[model samples]
Target: MPSAHRERRRVTWWVALPAALALMAVVLGLLLLVAWLRLLPDALDPFGTRTEDRTGPALLESIQDMSRYEAASGNFQVVVDLDKDAKFLPDAVRGSRTLFVGAGTVGAHVDLGGLGEDAVTVTEDRKSATVTLPRARLGRAALDADRSYAVAKERGLLDRLGDVFSDNPNDEREVHRLAVRHIEEAARESDLTDRAERNTRTMLENLIRSLGYERITVRFAPPSG
Candidate 1:
């Protein structure tokens, strides 16, 4: 009788101990979850607001500031020809010209010199507009166009090689090697036209920014031919 009683007591304690521990663990987990939920708003607000809420207003202010600067300087001739295709425009013009300003400073400086008349072309519909800007008009912004161009040229070479040997990984590597060889050959063959173009583009962008036109828009014309 005594032994059986002791065994029964041990069994009860074992079962009770595990059950209590499990209950306590569950309670602790719930409390932690509640605390996290309460703190989430305060902790996440800054990052969330910076990425989603502040972007639009910030961009608008930048555009406005740039526009004001341009207006005050009164030194630019913004020519937007609505009779050309957008496809032929230079990459720089397509990318940088989209920035719209209403009244404040820009986060990044723009290099507008790469903008060219040759880049202006008509769209398929002929109803849109295209722009042709002079190199002098782009030099007013803060970014260094020459450096950008050099970087672009280097990346462009790699990108071209990637396009050529996209099917086979081994072929891709070989193509890259061949491309490098060709680039070296070309550089040895001439007076570094790539570098010259970069420098020229940078100078043009700086000149444009120096002038008072903050923003330039070119709507493309529909293509007739």
Candidate 2:
């Protein structure tokens, strides 16, 4: 009888210990969850749930404008008229420049009207030459405003945390910002002559396609007369 009682007590303790541990773990988890909720009350509303509908119209307009000018969805064009007396040659091309715009996911293209078909003719003085570019071969750029906003939002939160926690935001935001900054910097770093060239090319290609221009020609003139 005594041995049986001891065995039963041992078994009860083994079961009770696990149950108690489990209960403690569950309680801790709940507390952590509550704490997290307190920190980011809007976390459950991830898709801008609290955003006001009043801004809908404005947002749409902004989106439209961005899509047209900064985004890659609309047409972009620019024209650079050179002096008639200017002589542009192959060597003069070194100092030529172009402009670019960021439109949308597809990016910005170059302006075709700025470069005429006869612009590429090399002159005897090697002073200047016209270069015509087709719109189809232009490059496009991608932009992610939402990603950038998320990063800025996350960074704002970290700043409020008083330097105790690491200020790491979502990876998407970082990537988006890096890409935007890189393109902007590139535009600034490139020579003035070529600065607008990439953008112009992209724009011309998009415009030609949309306008049904099977063959589009642009002309460039010498800057110095």
Candidate 2 segments exceeding 4 Å error: 1-52, 59-108, 120-131, 134-142, 146-158, 161-179, 183-225
Cα error, candidate 1, residue 67 (Å): 26
Residue-level lDDT tens digits of model 2 in 11-100: 999989999999999987876776656653666423224555665443433432221222133322212221211244332332222222
The most accurate candidate by TM-score is 2
List candidate 1 segments past 4 Å from native. Answer: 39-225
Error of 1 at 64 (Å): 31
User: How many clashing pairs per prediction, in order?
Assistant: 47, 40
Angstrom error at residue 84, model 1: 28
- The C-alpha lDDT values of all candidates are 0.38, 0.44
Give the range of the ten consecutive residues with the poorest summed lDDT in model 1. 68-77
lDDT: which candidate is best? Answer: 2
Whole-model alpha-carbon lDDT for candidate 1:
0.38
